[model samples]
Target: MSKLIWKALLASPAILGAAVVAASPASAQQVSSTTVPSVSALEATGDGSTLSNLDQLNQYGREGRARRANSAEQVTSVSQLSDVQPTDWAFQALQSLVERYGCIAGYPDGTYKGNRAMTRYEFAAGLNACLDRIQELLVTNVADYATKADLEVLKKLQDMFKTELAALRGRVDTLEGRISYLEKTQFSTTTKLTGEAIMMLAGATSANLDDLGDAFSGNNGDDNQVVFQNRVRLNFNTSFSGKDLLITRLQVGNSKGFNGVAGETVLTNQVFGDTGNQFTLDTLQYQFPIGEKGRGYLMANAGVWDDISNTLNPYFEDYDGGRGSLSTFSQRSPIYRLGGGAGIGVKYDFSDNWQLSAGYLAGEAANPRSGDGVGEGGLFDGQFSAMAQLTYTNDAKTFGLGLTYNYSYFGEGEFGFDNAGFVSGFTGTLAANVLPQQDAVTSNSVGLQGYYQFSPKVALTGFVGYTGVDSKGGSFDDADIWYYALGLALPDLGKEGNLGGIFVGAQPYLTNIDGDDVKTDIPLQVEVFYKYAVNDWISITPGVIWQVNPNQDNDNDDVVIGTLRTTFVF
Candidate 1:
């Protein structure tokens, strides 16, 4: 027999007499009113050492009760027992159960411990007593089945009890099975064992594939290039108790010359051949829940993350469907930059519909310097960034709003600056003169985005962003850029198991450097894409993109570009 069953047997009143010892006189007197049968009556032998089994003891108790009911026996000898104090919670639970299940309650004894802890053995005994009382109630509440005419009702009642017992046993079995499985199961999956990985691949190609033949309008020629970036991710999760889980993720990625402007190229010379891609540890972190509903969570990650515009822009094409544009916009919001770092964040779900999260990142906002001379670090050293986001979701739709701010102090170092007039390995005198000094450049940005669903298959998305850079004593006029976009999404595409959508966007800028020399020119972009689900673990996307004011060259007209891409996910 199992240890639990053996313990249950040893603790039974048949073996351990009902009145083994007594508490204080006052406490004993308080419980003396209840008429409890002597342990001797329930024993199989006179010495009380040779105890009866569970069934035998239960039958003896029932026979005694039956005899009293039939013969109206009175003046039964009552055995007094010491009152054992119970923990506050346990006593409360017991009282609640007694009221709810109509069980026999203890006498009016003011011995509720409220603090006395019970051992596992004692707890098992108390639970078994409660179960026995429940069984008795079940037997009594059911209609009597002692006659031939009541046989059908008796059988039905037996079936009902059997079903209930089966359900209870199934629950117990499930818990035991879970424990056994945990003991034997390995923590790592096959993919992890073989070092196979899953990655989030995203990038934007802003090339002047069709320049419309206008190349010389401004000093900064047509900016055109292709960018490919991917974030490799691996996660491990385990649970000590089934209710609580711990999750850890390792993230790594590479970006090929990532600058804010579309088609802006860096590191013209690819010294590493095709490996000139930007490398970064996007996210390495751990998360765990602290509450029953997982309402509270603790998370920490060290690596680079997407921080950019507040709305979905062609410049940031990551994620597919279900708030894809919204997530993408937030990733590229000017107030944000992806780089190496460590961060700690906490999230709390106020209810089913509301949540809040806050976090801080400590590290550089730009890529770290590499041996290729193209990469540079320490731009935002000794400076950290902070962000807070709020989300509200329901069955039909979800809305999220966030704010991010970053401040960097560069005492005396050569930081990177974008020279608007530099193009094609050429730097003009004006661009060189406008280059921002180390102590002058300080960046700040803010953005807002939202999504609304009109129906199951159709939804609207939009976002707006503003960014400013302060050159303490430089020639730049604290460059400010603003963007706004809206798109329509079709969730399902016929029976092909595909998703496709179209979007229209515009970005208008206001600069103080050129005054009337530079007009408020609006750049427009249009995109259409179709995604094919090749299988459970792979997908492909083919799309086309067109820009009206390419490179913000209003005088040069529009330019268009197209691409075909495929993805594999595990």
Candidate 2:
């Protein structure tokens, strides 16, 4: 085939994959980044036609073909990817593709690590993005390029290069058909809908279920029978400026969680339950640009640090969705969960690999009345936490590092420690099991976390954190808490889009008071799970969770929970 003919065929590869993996576009540079070569700049004339401006894709090799939708600004230069370097073997060879098509395909977390493989589903997503750009160009830019001189050039080529013209037009016809398919299959022009539903069949076995706190505060000798529960979330993501997003999420179902598992709230949904049929607004946030190097977020409700920063655990942290780890403690650093609810945050990238994130959230931002409770502290004085973080990712994107700090204050009677600070209502009783004894409290927490991707198929993530507590108006002088965890992820383990993961960590647990020991045991947690994608909208996961000591009490017996979880995404 002629070079031009070869170029035309490259478009096909971008569409062959059947998966729909969500691609992460470079966010910080969205407002004013470079773009691919334009069709009006190069020539694609037949033998007799005069040379004209053509797209830069012609400069790239066969393997460099790729593109994504412009919903976010596409990276137009290899330098923008940061992870790709000239020293790499494929660097120069892939530059043309990266310069024109957004890193030639990136992971869901926006990393374009070298030589990783792609699943069929993920490739399909690329195809959709390719179709979007191609259709957009054919419908708009091509017509504007049709000058009288250009037509005569084409006429001469059509007559002299009949065979090549025939083949070229044939490819165009195929593309036209694909474009039609795209038009017919689009979700919407202004708004897109995504949703997840998780159903879990679970049961626990423990030597004794007594002395647990919070929901499972008193389980004398009751048998932890098998139970079934579910959680569902629907997200309506709307974008008007292409670079900005308005997110509205709705949640329903019982999240009260398993009966035998006291205070071990792994999932964010573990907070409430037995709602019958009431649907609550789970998240309401707006993400937009701040100048050129910053992205900003305004969260009216249900906001956490994950809303505006990179968590660095793509496989293990699915934003608290059912697709990732089975427990909250394993998903991300407890520091990220410091405070949730109304907040404002921003992420600014100083260079390709370094970013600084800062935010403040108040657990009680709704109620005007003072005192303690959820969403009652107004904006500043209520239960709140302020956060700042500095992070770095390698040029290859295979490694990352972050240093995080959280400063928080909780009111007299508030209880959502694993969430905000020095309170006790969620997670392992030992982790968040403090603060009610005091009239009010303040905390200073520091955390270090990062991840290393060995390849497309395997990755490891680890983190350690510490929170120092000070009594505001209570009997205790000071307290100390600590936690750490490590997780391994194997993607596409048994089949495409399938994942197997294992994690072992200490849930944040109290260790001392006023330089003296507090009666608490190590809150060790071990969790293992595998998710097998049944198709585009469904997946099944089977997992086990073991708690060495519940409620920070060495006297309490260990508890193990085995569960089969099914998830639906759309």
Candidate 3:
């Protein structure tokens, strides 16, 4: 035993060798010939008298010599010791000590034997060798000699937050696995779902209806009664490539009672019924890139002018039932309604601030024969409007101006005087002055629209439009109409997502009549509204519209309309 201790002490080749020898008493004898036992064995044997500090140090000396003789390969990483794995509870500590302090060495075969029994003697010998190495590093002024101090701090920190760290790691692993599974099992990879719902309570009051010799006046006694309406939409937006989009919309509504056909009511809503209380495919549009500077949209089914135009009237063209203007005329220029049907449109951006847009839409493209098809009486020959607009946006992008022109060809029975084109204040119905089959007209319309943001929360918007109609072979007189409006809007009023607006304007009215003695009355319209957002997903709007002369006739009574609308989005 003395010789083995002397051998291990000399092999250390450091000051620790002298300390080791001095610490052990020469009188102490070997406890047993058996190999040094593990820590658990020492506790189990409980031979405290034989297990002296001097005896243990001498044993460490023997083991250190044996360990050095057998291990030739130096291992710096736990991975280099092939048997070590992260699942082992002590693996992290062993790795830190080996990597950070360069204190651990493996057998020539690269095995750590981490589970092998270890005695206090062997542990002491291992610690002594590590101390020698550290001293060598400090003497050489190596950069990593203070790793032991850092490790002490890290050890205390790890212990202080061990439970939280473990839980966080577990959650991260769970999330990663769940994301992987969802990627494989989720719905369409290219399609996403979106939806909107609207509810409205509305009523209108008017004193009398005018008689115009067979013209439809929508003179109903219940026109002033309050009624409830509902509309819901589900849209699927799909993308095959990154830059293109195809939209499919399914909608249903109970909005049949609000049309102007009832009591000369202004068209206040866009989500009215095609098939009341029944679900239907409302819109199908595809938007794709045309080039680096152009983009285009194709309407395969139910399309509207708002889908094709930038809608210079930026205040309220959302098309949702409960939002935007309470009256249709206040939404945009009536020319937009000239071709509110299926069509294709394109816009080319000359730069960030300038663009040119054009489109053609056929109002009655689903019927055939001499009146309403895509053929002689269809999209090409039936009632259709071709429109173009040039727009300029200011540097701040808060102001814009758009100049628009539209040319529409109307067939004998396809064009109606009740359309939005003539819904303004003074444009009285011309149906009584001409025979349906004998009268076909062509209209040329021009519109100027502009909006400026005076401040972050306030804006001013206005538009002026003119349309002139010429008769083909009918005996009716030609007419010209004019309409204009200026509005003030406050966005994010009271709170975010809220809006308030006031508008003063005139609906379309006849300005001139040729070859006839028909008298036309010019009417004025005033409106005020406020929209309050209850939360991120819901909003409510209340509004009122007053018309000085309803139906563009002097004999008719004034009209007042009131609406309370609520909207939900998801």
| Per-model lDDT | 0.38, 0.64, 0.60
* Tens-digit lDDT track of model 3 for 1-570: 133332332233233323222233341232112123332333344433433533443442333233333555665565444333456444555566557677766664434432132232233233334545655665676755544343233333233322222232333456668989999897657898988888888887744655432333233344457878778888999988978989999888776534232223444443344457688887888999998988898876666666766776566646534566666666766656665456788989999999899987766665465753222355666777788999898889789999999888776544433331222121223322132345677888898888998998898888888888787865456667777889888889999888898988866666566433344666677888998999988999899878775545666677787889888888
lDDT order, best first, reads: 2, 3, 1
lDDT of 3 at 256: 50
Alpha carbon lDDT at 57, candidate 3: 34
TM-score of 2: 0.65
Output candidate 2 Cα RMSD: 17.5
Give candidates' CA RMSD values in order.
Answer: 14.7, 17.5, 15.9
Q: Candidate 1: minimum summed lDDT over ten consecutive residues — where?
A: 420-429
lDDT, candidate 2, 359-473, per-residue tens: 9888878767886654456888688889999999999999999999989877765534455533344565533554544357778999999999999999999999998887778
Worst 10 residues of 3 by lDDT: 420-429
1 against 2, candidate with superior lDDT: 2
Query: By TM-score, how accurate is candidate 3?
Result: 0.65
Question: What are the per-model numbers of colliding residue pairs?
Answer: 11, 14, 11
Overall local distance difference test of candidate 1: 0.38
lDDT of 1 by residue, 452-510 (tens): 66666666666665545566655446665555667776666553445566766654343
Off by over 4 Å in 1: 1-3, 6-232, 238-281, 290-340, 350-354, 365-381, 392-395, 398-440, 473-475, 495-497, 507-510, 514-520, 555-559
